[model samples]
Each structure stands twice: as structure tokens, then as C-alpha cells.
Target chain A: DAGITQSPRYKITETGRQVTLMCHQTWSHSYMFWYRQDLGHGLRLIYYSAAADITDKGEVPDGYVVSRSKTENFPLTLESATRSQTSVYFCASSPVPYEQYFGPGTRLTVT
Target chain B: DQQVKQNSPSLSVQEGRISILNCDYTNSMFDYFLWYKKYPAEGPTFLISISSIKDKNEDGRFTVFLNKSAKHLSLHIVPSQPGDSAVYFCAASLKSGNTPLVFGKGTRLSVIA
Candidate 1:
């Protein structure tokens, strides 16, 4: 309850359907990030938020949308989930830029 | 292109021995480096970090060495135990806040007793 938490630990959705992955942090960190981990790729950042309303794209942002309306929540949305988007999603929160604490991760499967 | 590369997919080390994991980076702008340890189903936890100004940073049993000229870095675990077996990820950042980190594929360390 004191650290970051991710919702829907496991999910299976059809291609073309919209799916949202939720991330919540109790530390109220100023920086929050979303990353997807694949077999060959370790962790590619999808999006990051600096503050409540400031967000920016990372290495892999295509097809994924993120928003941070409040300091505690940063949600990632897949407008049209594709099979290629199937990967384990991770959410992290940091008080600064260097150190990060991650959630358990959400395993998303698209078919 | 991947800015950070961990080359080794996995490593095996005997218990009570030292385990060395290496990382290389292509970006010269990166000024900070960090190491993270991850379990099978858990997100990575921060292990150690070093700045460009210092070549080595040590904490407890974990130590990180950075070679700025070669754009290389390494994490060394002394007297590694079975509990130290996990996937280790290396990440680099250019600045603090807002900028996203570039991460390497990660190296899985297996400490066999």
C-alpha cells in the first residue's frame, strides 16, 4: 500500500479492442513511467509524466496513450490493441530521475 | 538502435564467488547509470548507481564501476549467494526529471550453491 501497484495482473484481449492498464502509486512521486518488456527487449519506455499534467513520449509510444491527471495515477491506454502489442507492462515511480520503484507488472496478451 | 547493450544473456557463478555483469552504451551524452535486479514475476528493484564524475560506487555487497571513455559500466556482486540470482538490468539517463532512461536487455545471473 506504500509503493506502486498495477491493476489487472493478467489480461487477455482481442486485437482491435481497447484496453487500459492502470498504475497507482502511494508515494506521490513527481515522475511516473510506463514500460513494456518483451523477450528480446528489456524494458522500453512507452510514456513518462513529469508532473500532474505534463507527459512525454519515450522510446516506444506508438499505439499507446498515457495520461496523468493526478500525481498518484498514470494510466496507459491502447486504442487498438494489436498482436504485436502483447507484452508485459510495467509501471514505475520515482522521486527523482535516477532511482525508480516498480510495480509487479501487468501481463497483457493480445490475440 | 539500442543505446544501451548488455551483450550477455545470462551468467552462472558459484556461490561465495564474485559475479561480474557488464554493460555498454553508445550514447555519449548519458551522464548517470543505474543497476536494477528483477525476479521472475516482479518489477526490477534499484540496486546501485554511479555518476559520470565518479568511476566507482559501492553499497553493501554491490558495486558499480563506470568507464566514461569507453562508454562501459559494470556491476559486481561480492560473495554472491543463491538469493542474488536474478535478472539484472542496466539503465542510463542524460538528465534528471522528464527524460526517459535507455535500458539494456539485461543479464540473468544464476548463483549456484
Candidate 2:
């Protein structure tokens, strides 16, 4: 129970509504990432943070926003969620380079 | 353009046999390669990884072979078991530090009993 955790394992939202998926890690990893997994897209990164207050865009970052105000927390926000954004979102943290630890994942559905 | 590609979307292997999962990358700058396994509705967990400096890295029943020249890599699971059935993903990164990983579409591996 000491690794990473995601809130609301399952979520149902409506289009044009805003939703925030939370990711928290107890390991205090220096790096944190938000990735959305779709059928044929594998895991596409939405955003990543190097440390607190430092974030950058990834492959798909149009409607999504992420902030790392603390090293242990990285929350991804979907501003005005759309049906196309429905996917399983995963949060991962890494203290080093090669190995990454992931949260259970949050299944978000926009109808 | 997908930087990492997993041509085979799915692979079926019988129990007690070998399960080979292949991955390829278009970018030669990628220096680190890794494999992860994901169960339904769960996040992927790191399985094995091989750096560009090495061609092979082994851990228990999982072995990763890196062919730098071909820009290809493979993961081998020996004597596959039913529990090994999951979606296997291949990822790559440029180098150390905060570089995020580039993941392939993944291959659904079914190890039948």
C-alpha cells in the first residue's frame, strides 16, 4: 500500500464538464508523468513534471493540463472533457531514469 | 509518425512454450529500452529493460534482447504460463534524467494453458 495511488478508479463525466484525476506517490520520486492509454495508441503521454512547479507537454496535450505543485502529487485536469478523451489514464513516477512505477489507473468515460 | 512500433498487435503461445514479443523503433537516438506488462484496468509494471550499451539483459524467465543495429528489441518469456497473459508494452527513451518514455501500441500476449 506504499506505492502510487489514483483516485476514483472509475469516473463518469459529461462532455464540456471539467474533471481532475489525481495521482499521488509516497516515494517522493523526482519525476512524474500522466499517460492516456487507448486501443491502438498504446500509452501516449499527456504531460510530465520534472519536479514541483515544472511541467511540460507531451504527445497529446491539447485539452489536458497538469500541475506538480508538490513532488508527491501530480494531478491531470481535462478542461471541458470531450468524448474523444475517454480512455484509461495512468500515472507513473520514477526516481531514476530507466525504471518507472505506475498507479493502478483511472478509467474515465465521457458521455 | 510513431517512434516505437509493435507490428504484431497480438501473440498467442501455449503453456510450456516460449513467448517472443518483438519491438522496433525508428529513432536511433533512443538509448534505453524497456518492457512493461499490464493487466486489464491496471497500470503497466516494469518487466525488464536493456540499455543501448548492452545487447542482452535477463531476469528470471524474462529476457530482453537489444539489436541496436536493426533498431529492434525483443522480449522472451520462457515456459510461458497462463498468468503471463497480459498486454506487453515496449518503451524507449533518449537518455537519463527526466526524459519521458515513448511507448509502442503494445502486443496482447495470451499464454494459453
Chain B TM-score list for all models: 0.97, 0.97
TM-scores of the candidates in the order shown? 0.97, 0.97
The candidates' DockQ values read: 0.75, 0.73
lDDT of 1 by residue, B16-113 (tens): 99999999999998888999999998999989989899999999999999999899999999989999999999999886433567799999999999
TM-score of 2: 0.97
Error of 2 at B79 (Å): 0.8
lDDT of 1 by residue, A1-111 (tens): 599999999999999999999999999899999999999899999899989999988889999999999999999999999999999999999987667889999999999
Clashing pairs in 2: none
Clash counts per candidate, in order, are 0, 0
True lDDT of residue A108, candidate 2: 98
CA lDDT of A76 in candidate 1?
97
Candidate 2 chain A vs. true chain A: TM-score? Answer: 0.97
